[model samples]
Target: MASRRRSLATYAVATLVLPLALAACGQGGDEVDVDVTGTAPATPAGSSPASPSAGGSSGPGAPPSGRTELPTSKRPTVVGTVVTGLEAPWGLDFLPDGDAIVTERDTTRVLRVTADGEVTELGTIDAAAPEGEAGLLGVAVSPGFADDGLVYLYVSTAEDNRVVRAELRGDRLGATEDVLTGIPNGFIHDGGRMVFGPDGHLYVSTGETGEPERAQDREDLGGKILRITTDGDPAPGNPFDSPVWSWGHRNVQGLAFDGEGRLWASEFGDSTWDELNLIEAGANYGWPEVEGRDEGTIEGGPSGDYVDPQAQWRTDEASPSGLAYADGHLYLAALRGERLWRVPVGPDGAGEPEEFLVGDHGRMRTVAFAPDGRLWLTTSNRDGRGTPAEGDDRILVLKP
Candidate 1:
């Protein structure tokens, strides 16, 4: 735990020098064409590697591919210029005007980045406590932002991990109000990812706070995906009649819904596996009791009682964080694997994942789609585990 703690702390402090390093590389915008070849280090045993598959097929129960059109058999290329000088940038959400709001995990600083690469400090979360992975993590622009101008954040406070909503008053965030509270918080496992589902409800992912038991405890708020309204009340028709939607997760930082409205989450594993699970309502994902797809371990929930991950990787290959669904694929940003993974999805299931930008940009954290049909990826090189480049912690724009 101490080593892990140090890693997280180092990542935070390393960002302090990011501005200086980025300035030497030409400050704001620098163009570099990235090779999107699906080649990285060989997949370690027990994890699936990326594969090419038919692109337009629909997954089971998936709706017709209307606006979710995917690129067919084409490799993505870097858009040449990157948005630089971010400090441990964690979450990204685009505004109606094509501007983006980015969160700095350690500093609790929220920045407004224009489509043209202009950066401005929007505001900071005063109560955010940065320890290990606990800090201001995720940000989401209100679905109704055109009218209400509200922004939501998932932050780690001194007392607990919570979600708060604020208004964008001019250039800074206005007074904040808590939307959800009482989620368990610790130095290491404060799961922090928030997104408004297509169903018009807010879905929050939480970690087990380094306490494995909480993952299985249906009564606990940690280690589960919670669904609620904008005002923090449980969403109507929740499976448990509480905020808890699904249970038995260790640390889930990535959440995305496909064209089919199926929820997929990325989970961090103990030492063996990292999982990309197809989440179902009220289903239990074996966490303390199971690691990956049942390696015959007795520690998981009883057989036939828990759900298995649709895809898994050795922890070394994928400690996935933020997730985005675009063009019929799920893009996962790997922290330890230091690459962008693209998994093709259809109504059947997930195809083999392909790795991109491997070792080109160190420790990718978040993958989000822009309004212009491009993929915006953030690096975590300044986040302790990676060797910082000239413009460390940059946002790379990729064209699919």
Candidate 2:
């Protein structure tokens, strides 16, 4: 595994220059070459469009959410173009047949975009409470999907944030089953990203819900990395004998495992710093007490008790969301930074992170590895915090 990771790193470095060349040639105006130093337009407040819900009403007895419409923009130049016309698309997972499933944050819609760019609405999540940063967030296909046809979703409901399982009945979604519940929910900081780990257990990242104290509370589910079985029970061999795998996280949105089965996570910091951590069992990451590193000890904790972050960036430069590990590198999607970052990994640890596509795509979000070895990235410009260009929110396929 170590040798393979090193080889993949070589391939990634050798082909890294292709994107610059493609940007210069301007392939049919599909890609843009923008000045990284230029100022971006002021972002409009609440710019995401309210997609029509499938269950007649948008939420439980609530009125249809207001939609914010913007003019479409030209698609950016990338190695591959799979599909277009995704509204606030967040999570992405590909099926065995090469078709991909995507989740729209505000719309609560789960769409299946085929390999040929044909999009079919699989279903809409009726329980999704679309507000601020909470809604239908992450989607993952079950490893047994070929037989059980179950797809998992992480969403925020009116009362709290939870995880549910929905069966795929033909083209539409079947009945829903609640797997986990009682995660703290708020207008902001509802950490909602889940992935099945290499161990076949579901790993969930939750936020402190604007309450920094919850990060240190081991009993609370908020602001921690949770490890559970598919049945939502705490997985065996857990450090705390509970779902809490690690505590003291602010808002973790990105989770990925390296080739060696080591877990890496991306977290959004308060105002000073954003962090990338190597998650471990029963570990405490200083949150309210420490932001990036422990400059000094604080009350209720000692500095040596907490583990420092593996990598950190200023909050203005990196509000990282989704993370993907491929070609011996971890690709982190930065929201406020408006760029994609590549961090090379080896047996020693992660090296310095390098920026890519700086200011080219607005508010990049999720990064996922497709089955065909291409890296799929989503734009979050239409999420109310970014200046949306034409075709503002799009999925760009890159060869990395």
Candidate 3:
């Protein structure tokens, strides 16, 4: 397992220039310029654009009454910000003892946040991450926390971005150990997110390591999601016994599961489309070959197929980040898009996804479903994007 992961260090070094080489995406546009494949992502025929809000900003907009629609299609209200002043916060996990673990990109540190909004520095990793788009990113609570008090983190290190495990010691994380290393790193494509699925397996999302072409390669770890155990071996019954669950993604930063156990992923597209994907094991998603739901054949993929995107939008509308599901819907944080989007889900995994909140916050990052069923969100203006409203980086609770 280590050997396979180690193989990526070379690729990480070789393909580390993709973000600069790729064309600028979305550059303030309403329509996503379809990729070379030639077809735009399909939406319901009657789909109309959302209205602009009180603020100058607009897109898939926030509710007119200063509210949001619940997962049940009801209106939603603000529940107040939980924590504030997080610098480029990306992922979070609630602890067993009424606390939460948070990741910071620039600091390369994990923070433990208390209920009263106090944040204590946990510890730092030796992540050799590149600036502009990489650093400490994802955190996951151990399924055996009671016995081992372990927490897992995915980091973008300068040497290589990888996953590491640390023992949780009250407010500090102790004794960090590398679990999976050398997963391809770069300024933009070093994907840093991980989660423990219900099946007791660890799932990880990786980027194309700055190389768009790598996304289409099944033999490469870049642009793939992997399922592994605590020790970083591929989960059982993987396609071809590879650690990958799904492949051919540009950069997947957000992942969530609905009540029916369907996994949804959020992807960052180049120049045009931003994607929301319904994920299944052994599935292929078109990336470099196809950007969104474009009309054309995608070549050089597993089974040589072109997979369609579930939902897509111009990057101005939804450059989606972390994802969460509640009230029978999925809520995704839009980064470059600066909004929160709600997608209604049906019993059989089909539903129309529409943008719900825009301009309420700036550069939304992560959306989490708390244990008590409250919907929580975080903003990322501090990492540099929109106008930061004094202390704009905040964790907000959505009134259910």
Candidate 4:
């Protein structure tokens, strides 16, 4: 457990135990003040992106309900280019044979890319409604992919954000079926990221759809980390008896399990700070009520129990999106920061975070560990927020 330095002491448990009074609220206006530890490494000359003005949410989050001993780790470096010429590529996963299944956000196109750099269009999800930041987002290959041939997706529709699954046939996807539905939706803050945990349950991340109040509403699906079975039922032992595994998240976009099966998420913070949290079952991550660290600051003051992030950064330094754990470190892909952040994790919790590939790859969106132990990193230069370089959207393979 890394030390948490806050301006205020921890709140009493009695106040936090009361039923939350849900009310629509605007974004917090107070300046966020929290003790920031460690320093970001400098980027290469002439490679840095313009410093971003504040306004975003979440970077990464914590692990699931489980814990285990840490394993040996390794550092990763770019090894090769897997493919290029993509359009706002977001979700990425690999097939049993090592073929990559990718999703393009705006195009709603699902693609299969071979290791040799051969790209093939698998199909498109017509139901996906691509807007400011929502569309066909995260993709997860079934844990039983070799046998079930199923792939799951988190998609934004005109009505709501939902999870759907389809069979992966040769070179194409079969008819899609609803796995879960009725999540809130918005033009921005549509948290969409999915990964299967070692417990064989599906973990889904959702945003508050810009409704700060919704994040605190236990009945709402938005702004929550959900644990469900492949069929979308609430996973056994869930604290809320619903899909929610954790709550009060602004917008969680990245999730990865470490060697110990503990889950970590990268989140986007609003204006003040971006966060990397170790998720735990039923934990509450303060949203409108608090931003980065709950210094007992904020206008109304911190009234509820909220989990402090294991690590945090300025929004300009880490509007982090994708996250992956490899070689005993958590790799975070920063969008506004234009860098990859490596945070060392050990028995005492997260260590000092270091920056890498700063501005080297403009606006990284996703980073995932491959079957062969290499990492697949995707650039989000074409995501409408970033200035695209030549090959705007592409994938880079890295060795750890």
Candidate 5:
């Protein structure tokens, strides 16, 4: 597929720059809010606009009220590479001191990379059974890492998909403890992205493991966004009285929190549309019932039975995976589309989305904003999906 880059528009520093920080929710108390001063691009011509009712509440699952516009910034540029020669790098989160903890999906290797691009293998997660899309996927440092020294991991085992944590004792990991368990696992669709919300609760995304019916089953752990404490207990105000915060999703891989702390997710569609959804508490996404908009297409939108996606794209254009919110925009890493999408958002709604770094890196996977005000992106060519470049898989740094 041919890639396209949108033309950017310059905005004044005083108006465009706002207090935004890195994308990680696991920064603990060291979360630094910085202004990424620059210009933002206009949506390229011929691009589709976002849903008209993006900020308005349609019903149960609509975006909540009291939303506001975020500070906009300039387009991101690649400054340097943090590391290279990585095999399917997946989860990425930074420690308080700015070093990153990275996870490898198939190799089950956990690594700590310094800010200057020095890579060190911390340990291997022996419990993960790597097959297909399942393995050691998401890694997060504890919100209280300075005091607790704990780091959490989301791994796929033979029995089930689970989250485990261990102490980061310098160069090695201590014994692991199960934080949460019993999520449905499969050769495909084992959703394994995790992030800590500003509320200090862990938010986990789970796929239905290719079973469409499992998405609607409340008792089933699959196809849901779960909120839990660090100890694995359900958070206090969960709508289902269980760990489930939202349900009825078809393979959600990307999760990020906007400046207003609203949760947003990127979902893979079934041969139709890929979605960028504004998630709400207890809302149903109409996985098997709906794919994108309520345009009455075949297997398209439901009749007010499910929430609509904020924006959508053709499947070939955007098999979106990792998502990050930085500088008042949502950055989506696309696999099949092979581009980074920058969608401008506000309390009113989403604007036209522009394409960035298109086809320059193959099969973008994880896109995280580092504490030092740059973007960290990983490639997934070695995951048996895309054509591998010389590096096959690498971690590149971008300035946004």
Candidate 6:
């Protein structure tokens, strides 16, 4: 039972209730204000191929009611193959044995889903993970897994949500140690995504516990990506004096490093905007201050600085979730969009985010590249959405 910081009082609660969402709305005019949080006005989808900046409405939303039959477009259909049977998997990672571990959000368990489609129940964490948006979320393997036997996980517990490290034995997880704790613990804003950066340090994406204002708070871990060492201390040379690597995000769900070792993050925006941002050290992404580039103007006021998203969606195309960089492209999993986006990358961030496998599958949650050079993706169908097939929860492999 750990206590939150004194600063996380009101703003943290704001992120939990729906009202705080209004703060994410980017302010109009120039020079965005730091404290003003407002809702982003509803806008149509923008910038498709040809002229990406061009705007349009979101494609068909989730099925009208039960078992909504999705339309199939004649676009490039990415054939999906079942690589393994899994639970409601949130994050996927690979082990040295070529086996992969998948975290089940609601069931409070982890599975070693092998490439052969066999699932080995790897015990369960009976602590706590409230439904709505919380549960056992992102996971990352240690760089020294071969020697350390350590596995890191971001979980939402009844007491609080934070990052924990443990050892992986045969079928059970060994002693669990808390690396980082006391992040706001709402059903949302747990900011449950984690990844090992190129520098071998852990880079974590934490939601503002629904408190949009905390996204802009330098002293808080909410709505920010934190860089920490294996022992849970802030990595040396961090942009701020704290564990924060980047801040001012609504809910950062996805994290991936490009071929050049540049980090990219995908976020779940408010009703209007969902985003894909290139994460940089000591950068502030507009959250309560600004939503996207349109509202991040300098004239709006707060000169605290802001980072623009590489690409954004009309809220429909991108309940942007887990992301993985592979095949010279950045693959992002869309939870609300029910699609996978392939964002081409250059020296900067993204060039064009092409919608692949549109409506071909259900909601995509996590995407990871296997050592075999194939893409492994997880679906979120079981989480309060469309009907799950006989094998409701599953892990699929995609190969070009």
Best model number under lDDT: 4
> For candidate 6, what is the TM-score?
0.80
Answer with 1 or 2, whichever has the higher TM-score: 1
- Name the regions of candidate 4 deviating beyond 4 angstroms: 1-75, 296-303
Worst 10 residues of 2 by lDDT: 18-27
lDDT by residue (tens digit), candidate 4, 8-71 = 1222210111011111111111122222121221222232222212122224332212222222
Q: Please give the lDDT score at residue 173 for candidate 3.
A: 77
Regions more than 4 Å wrong, model 6: 1-80, 83-85, 295-303
C-alpha positional error of residue 70 in candidate 1 after TM-score superposition, expressed in Å = 16
- Evaluated against the true structure, the overall lDDT of model 2 is 0.69
lDDT of 6 by residue, 231-288 (tens): 9999987778789887777888888877666777888777766767766566667676
lDDT of each: 0.70, 0.69, 0.65, 0.73, 0.72, 0.65
Show pairs that collide, candidate 2. 30-76, 30-77, 31-77, 50-67, 72-390, 72-391, 73-390, 73-391
Badly placed stretches (over 4 Å) of model 5 are 1-73, 296-304
Per-residue C-alpha lDDT of model 2 across residues 133-241, encoded as one tens digit per residue:
8888888888888998999999889999998999987789987899999989887777777777877888888888889899988999998888889999999888788
Of candidate 4, the 10-residue stretch with the lowest lDDT total is 13-22
- TM-score, prediction 4: 0.81
lDDT of 3 by residue, 39-128 (tens): 121222222123222221111222223333334324344545667666667779888776778887766768887655677888877643
Candidate with the larger lDDT of 1 and 4 = 4
**Of 1 and 3, which scores higher on TM-score?**
1
Candidate 1: regions farther than 4 A off: 1-73, 295-304
C-alpha RMSD values across all candidates: 12.2, 14.2, 11.7, 10.5, 11.7, 12.7
Candidate 5 residue lDDT tens string, 1-400:
1111111122121011110101111100111222211122222222211211122222223332343333233446666666777777889999998888999888888998876667778899999998878889998899999999999999999999999999999989898899999999988787788888888988888888879788878889998888899999999888779998878787788888878677788888777667777776777777777666653333333323566677776666578888889768888888887777777877654566666666778788899988977888888887777666665577877766
